[model samples]
Target: MRKTVSLFAMLTALLVLLAACGGNQTGGSAGSSGAAGGGEKKTIKFGATAGPYSDMVTKAIKPLLEKKGYKVELVEFNDYVQPNKALANGSIDANLFQHILYLKQFATDNKLDIQEVISVPTAPMGLYSNKFKTLDSIENGSLLTIANDPSNLARSLLMLQSMGLITVKKDVNAATLSEKDIVDNPKSLQFKPVEAASLPRTLDSTALAVVPGNFALAAGMDLTKALKLEEMAENYRNVIAIKTADKDSQFAKDLKEAVQSDEFEKTIDEQFKGFSKPQWMTGK
Candidate 1:
């Protein structure tokens, strides 16, 4: 009888130990899920292209979020597509890089359920030349390097047209405009379409290079050195993007409020000198 009682007690203790371990495992799972859900999360990861945008998040947005009792982390991407991919896969909570138009198109193409949180100050595309001091010095038949992607290429052409170097055919959609849209090339400037990232390198050999702002900044070219910067359209400004489902989440609200904060504008003015502020910022 005594041996049976002792054996029973040992079994009961073993059962209790297993039950406690199971309870702890369940609690851990709940805590992880809670962190991923709406208002409970204390950490946020932001993805950005490695340049001005990433720097903006680090110097400006991160500190604001930190003060609000959140741990902020930034992941820098070298290419455009991966940032959105990372956001969609939950590798990041938000991203700051592409403009609204690009965001919409990319989402459509990839079927991502991400949406913009708020627009931010964006660097504008500019024409740079190591061979010529000014647009006037550009000779007829000079080779010009431009971004091959349709969106950037269109902007490059538009900038050239604005400067009276070329005239695009009327009624052409600015978003889809191409070399074929050019009706007149007064300078007879030959365009070599290359990757946007490669445009900065072309300055060594090409007479002129039209570089998008991010790549230019990444390449360490001075924005002030550009012959001219494009007049940024509102839709062309970069934005903070998050999962569509997170639109009403506490984290999303905090991210939007952070951008709208006066501290953010002050940081932009001090650190991001040449970037064009979004309309909402300027309207304030």
Candidate 2:
């Protein structure tokens, strides 16, 4: 009878021990707890295009995050679409490749629940030419390659207008401006819209190409070789994007703090020399 009682006691203790072990396992999941608790996540996956944007995260942001007890993993993407998709699907914790305008438009269009954590320094879009040395040398009906994406298309078109190559309608909303908005093209320039990633390659085929800073740098083109560099607006600067639900979480705050740190600015100054500073960084 005593042996039977001992066996029962042992079985009860084993069940309790198993339950305790299961509880510990649940608590050890850093992703769920850190996000919910608004503290440091043990591992953070950052998505970015395979270029300067990714380098910014690697050279500047990752070390800072590691110091804060977070493991930083960078996922390099070849195109603009995937980084945000990864973030939306919870494949990555955040991304640093797109500007606020692009982020807003993409999120609205795709029904993705993502928001900007903070803006970072961005390289300006510029007109590069293998055929012409200057705008003065630009010929009538010269084929010009531009970004097909609506946001970047408008931005490139606006820069062209600023340079007197074209003019958008005075009454059209700038945010949603399209090729149809152009009222005059004094140069009679022909426009060919392609993917932003493909703009760098257009330089070889077209008279001129409007290359965004990130893609241009990624392609190893010298920013100084461009015929003209657009004056970047604050909203046009690239930003770190996180899931909107995580916006108020602790990881979001930490990510913001890292970007705004003086060390981040110093790193930008040293490595990303030609990149334009955002208003927050410039104190403007």
**Over 4 Å off, model 1:** 1-38
What lDDT, from 0 to 1, does candidate 2 have?
A: 0.87
Query: Stretches of candidate 2 above 4 Å error?
Result: 1-30, 34-40, 136-141, 174-180
Q: Please give, for residues 1-284, the per-residue lDDT of candidate 2 as tens digits.
A: 99999999999999999999976654224455233223346678899888898899999999888777677889999877999999999989999988887899899999999999888998999999999998989999999999988778988999999888999998777767888888999889999999998999988789999998888998999887899999898888889999998888777878888898999999999998779888888983
Model 2 lDDT-worst window of ten: 30-39
TM-score of each: 0.83, 0.79
Question: What lDDT would candidate 1 get against the real structure?
Answer: 0.87
Q: Write the per-residue lDDT of candidate 1 for residues 23-117, one digit (tens) a residue.
A: 65432221121133343557888898887888999999999988876777888998889999999988888999899999999999999999999
